[model samples]
Target: MSEETRDEPQEQSLFEAPPMAEQERMVEAILFATAEPVTIRELTGRMPHGSEPREALEHLRRRYEGRGVQVTRIGEAWAIRTAPDLGFLMRQEVVETRKLSRAAIETLAIIAYHQPVTRAEIEEIRGVGVSRGTIDQLIEMDWIRFGRRRMTPGRPVTFVVTETFLDHFALETARDLPGLSELRAAGLLDSRPPPGEGEEDAEGEEATDEGQEDLFEE
Candidate 1:
């Protein structure tokens, strides 16, 4: 019934009395520091250690909803993206676009996430034999390419992602690819690694814990 009581809101805000500017800055820091697509879960995990981050992030997203820079979701992941009006800024002076298949996209993601991977490693992750033609297709797209040999017997060649792949993915370089820890955190790998490539397996030919192919698979 008192004026002072009336002035206060009915429901207490989730965040304490922290300055709004500082809260926004913290959100910005989390966004910039993370190399991978961070989710609401990961964002909240990094908050004040005592304070929650969800309400702050939801608040932040609302604040930025229509601004030049906005927080957006892709699947369950989140990222700060430039406004569509600014899409022109990201365009290259020389333009070329490439099309890829579902198989190619799957292969490219495997290579990007697990670089220095070999054909056997890719096949295992895909759970199906990678057509020699699929590799050739990726090569034609200039998105993936061969790396140096693994320095093992027969000098087995390794495969790594190319700079073009990074460019297409809007990343700075291969180092910008999400780390194993980050990938695990995002839960993107929860999906099955496809089906086995199922070639005749010898004792020496199988998948290793690191998901690297066995030594004698060649």
Candidate 2:
């Protein structure tokens, strides 16, 4: 009877995988509930002490590889997002070329024109909130960079257009920006001012700009 029970145990161990299914479920739940990219520190916090979700995530990622969505890591963060090829299905439109939103375009223009300008200035011009992703998108596109500090009260970090931005836009320098007249000719800007009291202030000769000139020479 003892020998028979031993044989039965070995047979069950060979064929059964009960614990892995549970691990997979937990990992899937973590990724689903997390809107921001999640990291190992975060997952371990919610998991039983010393449990290996990293190994399990690798397994799940392999299963998802070459499929609709993918599991990817950005810096220290991990996220499951739509695969590039299938992103079109999630949208309502037919997905013509993506154009920047009015706020984004306005932000880009300010950064291009006034650059090394502060976020406060960008916000002041657009009259709206700005998200990190907005900055990230511009960074990912290599169109902007963190620029020299303003010698203001807060010593805020400012943004400046990258060489890539100038290259892409075919401008010799920041000074070449279409001017009110040229932007109108290119149909890139209408007569309406960008916004705010500072909008008028930005197009003027300021001491801050004098410092930025040597910094962004391209």
Candidate 3:
């Protein structure tokens, strides 16, 4: 009946966000296209001003509950991942690019459990000198990286596991790693005492880069 009233409706329509269903689709498209887990802040930045990405994600996650691919959480981010039970079907497509030696595995485990650890500290725990090559290989794989330098003494640089490591293992954080008791229960650890210094050197030497077995198991 009036110009102001007619214009009011038109103005409201211009600022109104898309329906929840459309917002869900927007989130789905973004999560599908992204290779890494995305944070809510990132989704908010990409969506329309009036869109609610968090609520959209909640709806989308519930909708995908029993699907072959489901929405998953990684730390503070979200991702669309293969359903845990269906992961076997995708394993055949995975390819191992390189191998990790026993030394490398030990070094990685130590750094993962005790992050921000210096080279000297790693060697102290393992009772063996760590080769530069072992550290280099882990860094090259993007699984581990240099952390801050220690404040004491020479300020030796520390090593810590990266997001790639957490993603690969599907862990929310380093705290998710199994404890020693869990490892023993799973038969991953032996009751026998650890090898002596001499035996450790021998194993480390025998499992060189070229002779190492596959590090990634499908």
Against the hidden reference, what TM-scores do the models get? 0.39, 0.41, 0.70
For each of the candidates, give the backbone clash count: 2, 0, 0
Instruction: Kindly list the per-residue Cα lDDT of model 2 for residues 60-175, writing each as its tens digit.
Output: 78888998877766445566777756754765544443444334455677788777789998777655556566677777877789999999898999998865554433344667
Cand. 3 Cα-lDDT: 0.75
lDDT of 1: 0.61
Candidate 3, position 79, lDDT: 88
Q: Tell how far residue 38 is off in model 2, in angstroms.
A: 1.5
- Single out the weakest 10-residue window by summed lDDT for candidate 2: 205-214
Tens-digit lDDT string for candidate 3 (1-218)? 89877778433445779899999999999999999999999999999988999999999999999999988887788889888677668756767435444677667778887898999998887777898888888899898999999999888999999877777666778777644443333343343434653224433543332222222211
Error of 2 at 187 (Å): 18
Q: Each prediction's Cα lDDT score?
A: 0.61, 0.62, 0.75
Give lDDT tens digits, candidate 1, residues 18-119. 565676678778876765557667866776544446566677779887788777554355567676566567656436444443455556667777788887
| Candidate ranking (lDDT, best to worst) | 3, 2, 1
Off by over 4 Å in 2: 1-21, 93-218
The local lDDT score (0 to 100) that residue 97 gets in candidate 1 is: 47
Query: Of models 1 and 3, which has the larger TM-score?
Result: 3
Worst 10 residues of 1 by lDDT: 209-218
